[model samples]
Target: MASTTQTKSNSGVEKHADINWDELGFDLVPADYMYVTKCGKEENFTNGNIIPYANIAISPFAGILNYGQGLLESLKAYRRDDGRVLLFRPEQNAQRMQIGAERLCMPSPSIEHFVEAVKQTVLANKHWVPPPGKGSLYVRPLLIGSGPVLSLVTAPEISFLIHACPVGNYHKGPINLLVEDKTHRATPGGTGDIKTITNYSPVYKAIAQAKARGFSDVLFLDAVTKKYIEEVSSCNIFIVKGNVISTPAICGTILPGITRKSIIEIALGFGYQVEERVIPLKDLFDVDEVFCTGTAVVVSPVASITYGDKRVEYKTGAETVSKKLYDMLTGIQTGRIEDKMGWTVEID
Candidate 1:
């Protein structure tokens, strides 16, 4: 944890939040401000600005409240050792938000607008960004249909906002996952590939049950075939067998995670044959290692996965491939190592 002494940032702002940095977790610890913008259903989003973080008023008939029309994107800003702040591939998040927006029948900010809003929001709450290695400032961008409507049509207005909070590891360490065979996360031609608000909460029942059984999360198989593995409730899954790395292909079923994409490129650069194809659940028992990737989980190794009466354990520790990937990824993200790929954008 960083010293609690008062300090100034490069932007002449407080260097840290008053809360105990050592106690940071994935939970929200509201920061000082957020970014917000609104647009009519017909107009494109033109601009947004920083605003004090607080509860947003929405009508009871708002589409987000009534029809669950919303999309969310997550990214993080890291305070480097030298006190510089960096964001990893925020444009990817922007592109993804546009994809989700189109699918949900809503207008989205362009990539430039999205990136600028994120930069402003992060710099505005620079103090909420934890000290080097302590944690990161988790930025959440939400695009919602905030307009009131009584019918089943798209709302008259849309909202795009970004909020952030300092966070520690989403999962404390290596996680245990339960294979949900009965309940499915998404069906064919559904909203699985996007980060829409509706794609999450339905799985809460399965996750709640898994947690009660002492598992960290739940993994869902493909809804149609129920044979191939899809992804976890939140992150994308990967399996390592010998020199090959494989993950479920994004066939409009699995969320195309930014971290998952970067990890694949990194693995290929390391001379590993990476595959995006159907991964049978049975392969879990034959794999040498298993790990998951996401904005929140990063690259968490799978300690154990339970399917039916069977359970398979994977390699975990500092010597694992996941650890190496995590190190390289975080190194590039935090400026501890040269970001040869130019994936990070520094906040001035």
Candidate 2:
């Protein structure tokens, strides 16, 4: 908490001393500090520190010198109305990063280290935290193969770093998406369940095509039958029918988003039947509503969906449930709602 002493200016706008129970939007200039650490082929994680954020020198044979061995996680920090700094379920991001690290045959940062590093980074930039309601800061935790070697095979040298930016909604409002039955986001026994870099580049071609056609995102289907839904490039998909909520099961091909899980729990609490099973694209045209969940989108409604030659429209283009869920989430995040799940962690 910032000191409770409040400062008053001549115009009558008061400044918070230590505790800021209020939050306002900020214009983010990247914080001046960051945390970095490295690990060897056989080692676990190494100790590191926060330093001035700037340029770095790298060897010609860095592990990421190749193309596929890297991973990242994204989340946010808020400066609430009273000037309190908070992180929403940062431990989930840290745990997901640990899983992603291991998927690439790299070292995993202990959850404690990951959370501590995030707190340290946020504390280092407390002054830069925009006020509440202005888009919050986007925190990105990245891991890359830093081992110095020139080869196509995976060897040791892995590294971790944390960076943040003041950010807003990824997509401002209801978005149009295309059903992708052609390409695969991840293969069986692949890194689909993890948030690794190698897993996402495969969709660039599909994503490019969709954007070219004016679609905001791609709705990927199952790799096998090419019938059921998977997820968007950066989010998990959900469809609501009256009182029921449906999403694709985590059958090893989806990112198993943290937001997805939280929404499911919230929906259940609201007396809705949340089902996790195979969700076919056919359901979209017939469902009551549909939307997406992610660290970025949180919950963005789907007004309409377009494929090559067909479009699926819903009566209630704006989903009542998704909007409610989003409100519940942001409410908890901004300290206006209860934290029943213990997701929010106060930074200061």
- Top TM-score: which candidate number? 1
Backbone N/Cα/C clashes per model: 0, 24
lDDT of 1 at 215: 97
In order of appearance, the predictions have TM-scores of 0.97, 0.89
Instruction: Tell me how far the alpha carbon of residue 87 in candidate 1 is from the true structure, in angstroms, after superposition.
Output: 0.5
For 150-269, candidate 2 gives per-residue lDDT tens digits of 667555677788877666667856888998888889767877898987777789999999999888989988888887888888899999888899998898998989889888988898
* Residue 15 lDDT (model 1): 55
Which tens-of-lDDT digit does each residue in 320-343 have in candidate 1?
888988898998899998999999
Between which residue pairs do clashes occur in model 1?
none
lDDT of candidate 2 at residue 308, scale 0 to 100? 69
